[model samples]
Every structure is written in structure tokens, then in C-alpha cells.
Target: MSSIKWPKKRLKRIVRCKYGDSLSKENREKGDVNVYGSNGVVGSHNKSISFGKTIIIGRKGSSGSVHFSENSCFPIDTTFFVDKTTTKADIKYLFYLLGLLELDKMNSDSAVPGLNREHAYSKEVLSPSYTEQKIIAKYLDKTCASIDTIISIKQKQLELLEALKKSIIHKAVTQGLEDSVEMKDSGVEWLGKIPRHWKAVKLKRISKIQSGLTLGKQYSGNLVKRSYLRVANVQDGYLDLQDVSTISLPKKTAAGLELKKGDVLMTEGGDLDKLGRGFLWEGQIEKCLHQNHIFAIRPIKSKLMAAFLTLITTSSYGRIYFEATGKKTTNLASTNASKIKAFPIPLPSKKEQGEIVDFLNKKTTQIEKLKKNIIKQIETLELYRKSIVHECVTGKRRITDNDLKE
Candidate 1:
């Protein structure tokens, strides 16, 4: 089998490129041609700004993402398109070549982040003969497509695993493991049949729901600023405190709103998915208060466990209730203090609650580890995909027809 010989060349020697034209969103009319962005097609527009096969390089914003369009399309001003006027090399090859060059690392703007066209053009690139370029691009186009499809499948697997974990949690908490034991209608249709012994209770009966401190509002009493949890800090069933910030509140408010060891923290509301997202605050930080957008629930120690409460709220049954009751608009939904207080919770023995929480903690952790492994595989495959593209385009890995066999 004969191997293809390739020659090294500078990018400027191979092709010409320039920034795309400005097109305002308001002025654009809907049509057939794809509107290209630095990363990919942003939308579709009626008029075509560039003709034929095009390569779009990010000039600003996304800075260095490259996208290709086979048909004539509009590349917005946020990007630079490989000019159709003085084109020499295979556009598809140049697309892969740019991927090898790591153009995104060549950011020029300190403030807004941009790609310097001259800097980009001066970079050295391997130029294969037209026939060899076509062969290489074809191999990559097919192989990368396969890899992407695998990644998508693995991603879907991850989604299924997560859903399964949630299902396990929901079942263990609501129905309990002894499925054959006596079951009774929960009255809440979504909840279905729970254990016969369990009692359904409103949140207000077992916990004091208190709203957190309000930021940017003047208070009557003397106040001081303190660290607080924002809506972003509380995630579904967990807290991410990587970027915690402080908010000012009256000393009294701050003191009253401070998180206790077993206090369950829930966001007031935001987007649909975020409506009832929360987690138990196990004294993660000292003197940490929450924003007005978040509410801290002090559950009566004798009646309930914080971990159990968080799981119940995150379950599908609780999610159904909150989404239905929340004040929803086109994009945002909020569960007010009254609704949150009136939330229905299944009351089981404190011992049973502790057991369920313990089971969930262990089970979810195991599932998460499995998910992490799958994610790592996806990441490895992705990195390998990028490496393959770079290797083929840069002549680091010589292309051969036999590669198609493997």
C-alpha cells in the first residue's frame, strides 16, 4: 500500500481570510441560509453574505472557534470568514488545520478577547496535495462522526443512570423497601401509594421557614455585611460554594438568618428547573447567611432530619408539586414563602427517615462514581477525537487508506 506524501506550508500561503460583515438581528429576515457564528450556526437568515464553501474563525467573543459551512451562508461580524476570493487550499482541510493550530489560545484582545487575523495567518501549517487533503478530510469526517455518535450515546447513558438513581431515591423514600407490606393511597395522586404507617404533613407544621437577608435594601436597624449563600450556591440536592460572596444585612437579620448545622437550604425560585432546588446545610461555613432569594429551613430536630427533607424535595413527586404551584412566566418560576411552607412531606418514623437518608447517601454516591467514570470515558474519547483531527491535519500521523479498515 502506498502512503501519501505531504508538504509543510504557512497558512497564509495556502488560503486567504477576512472578518465577516456586520448584520443586525433586527434587520435580518428569516430565510434558508445558515447564519454562521464563531462556534457554529447561530440561526438562519434570508440573505447570503458569503458564497460557496466557507470557514468561519472567531474574531471576537468566542475567539478562535472555527466552523465550516458547505453552502453559501452569512457569517456575522463576530467572526472572520476564510475569503472565497483568494482561496487556494481545501476549505475542509483548513478547518481541521485550524483545529490543530489551537487558534483559541491566540487571543489578542485583553478586554473583550479577540483573534488577530494577521497573527492567525502567520502560523505555519502542513499543506497536503489536493488529493491527499481530500483523503485526510474524508477519513476525519467519517471517523469523528463515529466518535461523536459514541459520545452522544455515552451521554445518554449518563442521563439514564442519573434518572435511575433519582428513581431509586424516590422509591426508597416514599414507598420503602418492603413493597409487599400494606400500602395506602397518599391522597397526593403524584405520590401514589406510600407506607400505611406514614403520615403526610405540611412543612410549616414541622419546620420554621425563614427568608434570608435582602441585599441592596435599607434597613431600620443598624446593619453590617456578612457572607451569604446566593441562588447559585445551592444546587439540586447539594451546595457548590466555589464562588461565595457577601451581602449586607441588619445585624439582627444576619443573626436570625444564620445557617444551623441541620438547616436545609432551598432557593426561593428562578428558572423552572431551579424552582425547588436545594440541599441540607450541614454547617458548611461559620456565620453564613443566605440571600433573600434563598430560604433556610430550621426543621424541628425531634420531627425530621435535614438530609431526608432535601431528598424528598428533590424527588419527582415534590418536583411535580412545586412546578405546578410556582408562579411561572415564560422562563422563570418562583415558589413563594407560603407555598414552600405548605409543601407536603411524607412523615415516617425518625428512625425510618435516618435509614432512608443513609441508604440514599450510599446509593447516590455509588451512582455518582459510576457517572463520573462514564464522563471520564467521554472526556478521554473527546480528547482522543481532537488529537486525531490535529494529527491528521498537521501531518503528525500519516494518512493511509488502510486506516479506514481499523
Candidate 2:
């Protein structure tokens, strides 16, 4: 028989979602009990509010999301929960049904958006018999687990690919391309050793650090307006010039700040890994300037090649140096012009610098292509998993005893 012919019932008749109690960080005693928030397990506590199998529904924050706990758990005030005692429906079946409803989409229009229980209770669904509900849940449990395993394998492959790329770049920039070259101690612990012929010198010796134009300053007379680059416009190896903004500045100050071809741009700070993220400017935008948060390093033509400088600064060595020296808060790290000028550069001959840059450009391109292919496969698998859950819970796909046997 078609699922459309099944008896109709409101969700409230099958289950009741109770409000979770408030548990603050100060009061929480750590133990084995899972402490849940709007998303899922946030921490562990010494006590649990609900016992046995339970379904947690997000009330705010990640509103409409669902989480299942096999044993007792404490659901914080940001969520609501239902257990065996609160529902006549099969616990697993209700979990699948709620997922199909996409509760996150039914958000309230309050200042801090939340889910209203009244709206959720009014949602009508097909009511199958007790025995059939268990059967549907059983089928989904097996099928979804199989799909999840495949996704996990694909995700691992992506991590491996990224690690491989980082390793390749780290090796080329720190050690010269020639394997037979004599080695000398770089003195810097994180930098280890380098080619015997290279010199370890301060960046200020070979490059002029030009601070960008600071925003929000009031000019006394008619000021010239020009497009400028923000930290967002620059990535590790490339520029995103599509949405560049314009700023007003004194004509002389604007001219001095104009980005030149082969000038390397670097950000002051962000996340630990993103500190000093930068790219060399190829003069993509005409008369473009950069914001104060970004530093433009112009290499002295005879001493350093811009391409080589960009590669070393974006490599693993640069990341290590920035992270170690940058002044850090709990979530972000930053460096100032003085720190940037003092950066140590592992100097290679001008001829050798160009060779290393060319080699890395070709190798990194190949790794990126492979990564894009795997990412696409993972996206497709996730969509398929969602469709399967929706189909089974809604009875669009019926499960028979013989089907489970296979």
C-alpha cells in the first residue's frame, strides 16, 4: 500500500519535547555524562537530566538540528529533548522523522532566532503501526552507517592530499633543489640548515616594508580616490580583485602607497595558521592601494627576487616563524612592522630563486587538481545520504522483511 494511505497524526500526539535545564560552565562538574547544547555534545558532566535513549532538538543557535544519545545526558537550556517516557513512538523512528522535517528551516523571527515548539507540534505526518516503525528505523540504521563509512574514507584522502602539498613546498623552500649541495646550519631552530652558499639575513636589509594607507582619516582638502586592497582581497598565492573598494587620500600619499608590480603583500594577523598570509602583487588593478593591516614588501632588485620571496613567506617555514613570534590572544595572532622587518630570510642566489619558484608552481597545480576532484565526490555522497533518509522516514520507500535479509 502507498504511504499516502497511512493514518495522519500531529507530531504532538506521538511525542512531547520538554525544555532542557540551564547548566552554566561555572556549575558544571566534569565526569562521564554528556552535556548537550543546540548542536550536540558540548562537554561532559557528573549528572544527567534524562535517562535511557533520548532525542535532543535544538531550540536556539543551531535551531531545528537533532541529536541522539544512547544513554542518559544533560541537555542545556539552548535545547529541548524527548525520551522513551515522553513519546509513544519508536525512539529511532522519531529521530529519522525529525531529520526529514529539516527543523533548522522553521526558525522564528526573533532577534535571536529560535524554534517554536508550537509550530513543530502542529506539523502533521503519516502514522504507521508500531511494528512497521521499528522495521523502517532498522533499515535506515544499517544503510546510513554503510554510507557514512564511505564518506569517512573520502575525507581521509583529502587530508592526505593537503599534507602532501605542504610537505613538497616545505622541502623546496628550506633546502635547495640540488641534492648534492653542501649544507650549513641556518642557526634558527625552526629553519634547521640551508645550502652552504646561502646567507641568513634580516628582511630589512634586502626589502623596504611599506605600510599601507590607514582608513577613516579626515583629509583637509580635495583628496584623490583610488581602489585599495583589503586583507580579504589577498590569499596565500593569489588575489581576489573582483570586489575591490575605493578610498580617498591625499594625492601624494596615494601615489606613494600605489602597489607596484612584483611587490609582495602580507596580512598582519588572523587565525594562527593565517598569520602573515600573503601573495605577490602582479599589478592586477590600476593605481590600486592596500589597507593599513596589510604590509607591502618591495624587494631590492639586486638582492631578492619577488617570486622567491613570496614562495618562502607562504611556505611552512614562514608559518612557523610568524606563529612563534606573533603576539597571540586566545583566538588570533598578529605582528607589527618592526617584527616583519626583522624576519630572517634564507638568502639564495638570484638565479636559483627563480628556478625554485617555477618548480613549486608546477607541482602545486597538480596537487590542487586532485584535491578538487575528491571534494566533488564527497559533496555528491552527502546529498545521496540526505535523500535516502528522507525517502525511508516518509515511507516513499517501503521496507519489507525480505529486503532486510539481503
Candidate 3:
């Protein structure tokens, strides 16, 4: 810690934030110059907006976000560009200092969020000597880079965990736990092989695909209100249930739509990967009706278990089937009840199904626990990175050429 009293100065006196020029898709010529938006590099262009190293501040959209470019780049209309020529302070030091200001909070109240430059200019910052500024920046450049590397490693661990979970589920559902069992070709392309005793059956043969009630329908007679699950409430492998909304419907209609325990809930549309992705609903909420966009697959007690079917539907086999059968647009894909009813399910005896479900449940739980621990580690590293940058830039932690040696 240093006892030096750094001079306080208005932000405008330390650096000038120049308005970035608009470069639309139609006009941009492809080159090495990075085209910067408010957040970061968005595209490439032939011409450079600023020479050498520069700091880009988000002016609109991702308002107030800070990005550093080591090379000459074009900052688009949605950003503010600053370079060595615009600041008396070391440009690198200014980048770290501006990040600590929380300029994102100074965004104007509008339909589209935007940062007001005047509000940013009015804020005060501690001004250190130019020499100290470079030292702090150099130290931070090293420190933050180290933190980022750790974060990246943790992120890769999370990815591997997810891939492991998916792999386990796919193998368990498609190939039975008994390795010695005789195998046969499952006619379904995605579902390549299965045990000899197992039979490939359409989902509708073993379960009923129940379509939910439509919203905004004008109903006659007395209206009864009940909580309903929408597409948003049903996530890939679990129900969010945090903000269950209510809808008004006739008591008869509401009763028919009420969710039963052991129903597999799946969304009808969204991103291609999200289509047909869902988990089994265990009657978490009583008297809950679901929207038309969500399909509740009620498995026949005699033939299917919701948990077992849920595993099959969430596996790679299900993903491939849904993507192949689903109607596609540019970015969105959807499946109707007819398509869902035709979903191929590997049918084993009740005993085998229960055993598979139990095995998968234990495996997935362990994977999820590992994922949570890794996520927490990443969050901690990010927080520490932010705190250290703030302290060094504000002179709370003084760095010198000698400190760099340590």
C-alpha cells in the first residue's frame, strides 16, 4: 500500500471520447482492421478508425462496455473510440480506470439503452503520474491475463463435464447396461442399435401426447383462474417454476388441462437444439395448466415410465430425430403434436427401464455437482480480477517496476 495522495481530476481532462463513425454492412470492405461495436469486435473492414492501440467504449446497445484493441481498428457508430492522442493519461491505464467507473449504470432511459458521454465526462477519477500509470497497467496486464487463463481452463472443465453427461445418457438409453446382451439394429437411423429383447416403438403407442390450452381465447360463462406452465417455465432438464403465471379459463377446461404427476413436459419451438428438449414434471405445482406451446406427454402406467421416456427424449438420439423431423426456418425450428407422437422410444421391460433410470440419475447428479463447483471457481476468479484492477487503477495498490519483479 502507498500513502501517496493522487490528484483527483474530471474524466474529460484525462481523456476525450470521440464519437465513432457509422460503417454499415453494405459499405464495409473486408480486411484485417477489426470493426468494433459497443461490446467488442463485430466484423472486419479495410479502413482503420484509429491508429495504433485504442480503447472502445460502448455508446449504445451493450452500453458502457469496455474493450481494448492492440491494433488499428474501426469503431462503429455504436461505440466511442479513445487513443493516445485523446488522453493525457496512459491509454492502457485509462482503459482499466474507465472500466472501474461502472459507466453502464449511467445509460439513458430509452427503448434502446445508450450511454450519455456528458455524464461519463462529469465523473471524477484519481490521476497518477504518467510513469505510475504505465507501471499499474503493465502489472494489471500480467495479473488479469493470468486470471483469464484460469477462467478459460475452468470453462473447459465445465464443457467436458457436460459432454460426459450427454455421453453417459446417450449410451445408457441406446445400449442397455448389460454388455453381454445380444444387440439388434434399431430401424430408426439416430437410434442405431439396442438389446435383442428391446423393441423400438413410437411414443404415441405407449404415451398420450396432450396438447395444452391456448391462451387469449375468449371463453363464455364463469372464468376460473389457475397457474399455467408456458414454454419459458419448462427448461431442458427441469422446470423453472420460479415465475408461474396464471390464466383464466372455464373450470371444465382448466380441470382437463391440469398437469398430472409423471408427465414429460417439452417445448414446441425455439432454437433447433431447444426443440423437443424437456424434463419430466412431478406434479410440482397443483392445479397447473400448461400453454399450447408446451406439450405434456402422459406415459401409460402399464407401458412407460415418465422418467425413462424423459431420458430417451433428452439424449442425442432424440436431438437428431427432432432436428431432422422438425420444420426449419433460418434460426428457429418447431415440431407439432403429430411429429412428437411419432418420436421413437426404445422399449425395454419395466424392470430394465427402472434400472436404467436409476443408474442415469446417480451419474447425472455427480456430473452436476462437479459443474457447480467449477462455475463457482470461475465466478470467484472474475470477482477478484475486477477488484484488483479497481485497486491498482485508484492507487489503493501501488505498483512499480520493482513490484513487477516479484
- Relative to the unseen true structure, what is the C-alpha lDDT of residue 311 in candidate 3, on a scale of 0 to 100? 88
lDDT of each: 0.83, 0.87, 0.89
Give the winner by lDDT: 1 or 3: 3
Give stretches of model 2 more than 4 Å off. 109-113, 116-119, 231-245, 282-285
Q: Name the candidate, 2 or 3, with the larger TM-score value.
A: 3
TM-score of every candidate: 0.85, 0.88, 0.93
lDDT by residue for model 1 over 241-300, one digit each (tens)?
A: 899998766787688888888887778777887677567787888999888888888899
lDDT of 2 by residue, 1-406 (tens): 2587678899889889999999998899979999999989999899999968899999999999999999999999999999988998899989989987878878886777799898899999988888888888888888888888998998999999889888888888888789899999999877999999998888999999999888888886879989999988876557888899998878998999999998989998778887875688888988999999999999999999998887777779989988999999988889989888888889988888888888988988898998898889889998998898777767789777776775
Which candidate's TM-score is highest? 3
Estimate the lDDT of model 2: 0.87
Over 4 Å off in model 1, which ranges? 1-13, 16-54, 58-61, 69-77, 82-86, 108-114, 217-225, 236-238, 247-253, 404-406
Ranking by TM-score: 3, 2, 1
Instruction: Rate residue 383 of model 2 by lDDT.
Output: 90
Task: Give per-residue lDDT, candidate 3, residue 370.
Answer: 93
Q: Looking at candidate 1, what is the lDDT of residue 207?
A: 94
Clashes of 3: 0
Pairs clashing in candidate 1?
none
